[model samples]
Target: MKFHNKKKKSSRGRAKWHALMTIIAVLMVVGTGCSVGFGQNSRKNWEKNIAQETVQVEGLEGEYTLLFLTDTHVVIKDSEVSAQEAEDQESRYPMFVNAEGVPAEEQFPEWIQYANEKKVDAVLLGGDIIDSPSEANLQWLKEQLEALDMPYLYINGNHDWTYPWEYMTDMGRERYLPLLEPFMQGNTAFQRLNLGGLVILGIDDSTNQVDAQALDRYREALMDNRPVIVMAHVPFMTQSALSKAVEAWNSPVVIGAGNFGGIYPNEESEKFISLTTAADSPVELVLAGHVHFYDRDVIEGEKNVPQVVGAAGYQGNAVLIHITGTEN
Candidate 1:
């Protein structure tokens, strides 16, 4: 559970040289371009362009502050993510980058400082704690979280369990999850937290399948009298792919060419939709990430329950929720 700042070791060490050579031999492309695939903006620009909205909900005794951070994708080696022999992986993103000032990557720590200074009740790490599931990267994450004063609820995004150069499968996760567990505060995949008289369900679904376990967990989390907040890395199927909304996105290309945005659909997805929209469903709000954008929507069928999907804040921005009239 120890975190360390990376020592300023020489870059020309034989070990570093060998690793660099291996990366070059594997992909044959040197991806260290000045371009940030996920382009960014200055804090000043975010302040001018970003607008914070407040929403009210039912069932609470005191105010609760929840900060949501998404798509951090901490690149451990400073090369393009996953050392993927390329740098333009972010070029296809749909966001209108204000690529003139400080990149979001450099501003991430300030977001943490803001949260701590505000003394938020808890922090929700939406997904992608690291761009690659490297031991070094996870250690880096552990170091970062050590300074926070509130609880951290989290889940894994596509980038979390993948190696720097390959796809992530359940098989890959079996080996990766153990290494990541000790560095995080709560369940990185599936777990429930009761704080401030609110039941928060954190579902970790890497694959698209809406499995029975997730639905069952969702159902059980609603058993309490307190309002419930459901969180996940990817969102549940609720709408068609975004077109105009695409401008707010950061990784549309990795998601798909035309497929700018939308949750994965399946049989389990129906059950999830039906239950969340049901009159008896205790969910008060749904918080999700992965699109690397800021958005808020009201559920079409559930009394217009609010759902706020956060941007990949680790790359740039974050959303904070203030709930009053709730007690833990």
Candidate 2:
């Protein structure tokens, strides 16, 4: 009986050793994967190499001037971390700089100075407010915006959805909405900014999910005869494989597509196209920024009116648009 007990104890000891080895091996694999994944994702090259330029367009010749800029990808590294140390962390998400993460007041002093000098009636932040909603970054951006004194509006971008599953949680987005709400007269979904004679309609294009109530509000604002300006983060085109493969993509649908369905999906582009094509009101311009490069397209609408997509400010340069209202 004593001999049998010794053998069982030995067997149990071997089993424990094997289990320990297995756990160690699994941990090593996971560690390697995380190291590679974070390294690959942490290259905020887009933020560092941004180009800032002001493009002035005199289309409608209106009394009010609106500034269109997007894709700043700002980042504010932690206080204890070196800027270089935070570089990798910044690259992992969009808006590399935190709104409250960095001293935006110092980083873009010229931008603020220019806005003051230009005396812009309204500054329309196209989208991609921050690389991610780092608590510090959001607060920082809000502080800077509050100091602006001039009117400003913010919408979401693809990067705002950098959380798990590439979607910005409702609560996360809502937290920052209060800071931007003052600039906008009414709600967050969409706002009809009445800047002098111009009617700036800022639309949320960060999600593919189309809020019927928001769109209805937008339509109501557009019905007015004043010149209409639309701002969104992503282009209203379904450029994804699933959308293109099934012939689900088209111009009419893509133009009014929202950021729903995940990164240029079929539903968004189709819906976008349908809206732009069917828009009976005078939509003087549609400004979008998601593509890092600058591009311009003129679509002839009713009464031979032109719908224009201005260049993106990915390089950190704001697109300065000056509209001169032509006498009828």
Q: Report, for every candidate in turn, its global Cα lDDT versus the true structure.
A: 0.62, 0.56
Segments of candidate 2 deviating more than 4 angstroms: 1-62, 79-90, 93-107, 161-186, 237-275, 299-314
Alpha carbon deviation, residue 238, candidate 2 (Å): 11
Which candidate's TM-score is highest?
1
Summarize candidate 1's per-residue lDDT along 1-328 as a digit string, tens digits.
1222233344346679899889875453224332334223213444412325454555576667888777766654444344342342343122322344444435556667777998988888877756667655666677778878878776777777776446675667678766766644334556676786777777766565444556776776777667888777765433432432444454232111234444435667667767777877777788777766666766556555567777756446677787665333
Candidate 2 weakest ten by summed lDDT? 42-51
Relative to the true structure, candidate 2 has a C-alpha RMSD (angstroms) of: 16.2
Off by over 4 Å in 1: 1-51, 78-105, 183-187, 238-241, 244-264, 326-328
| Per-model TM-score versus the true fold | 0.70, 0.61
- On residues 1-328, what C-alpha lDDT tens digit does candidate 2 reach at each position? 9999999999999999999999997787666654443533332222322223322233455466666667766565565655643664456534333333332223444455567777877777776655655555666676767767588776666564354333566765666455445544556567667776677777766665444446767766766766667776655443332243224333223343334333444454444444554546456666777654455544433322233333334344567676666555
* Lowest lDDT 10-residue stretch of candidate 1: 251-260
Each model's RMSD to truth, in Å? 14.2, 16.2
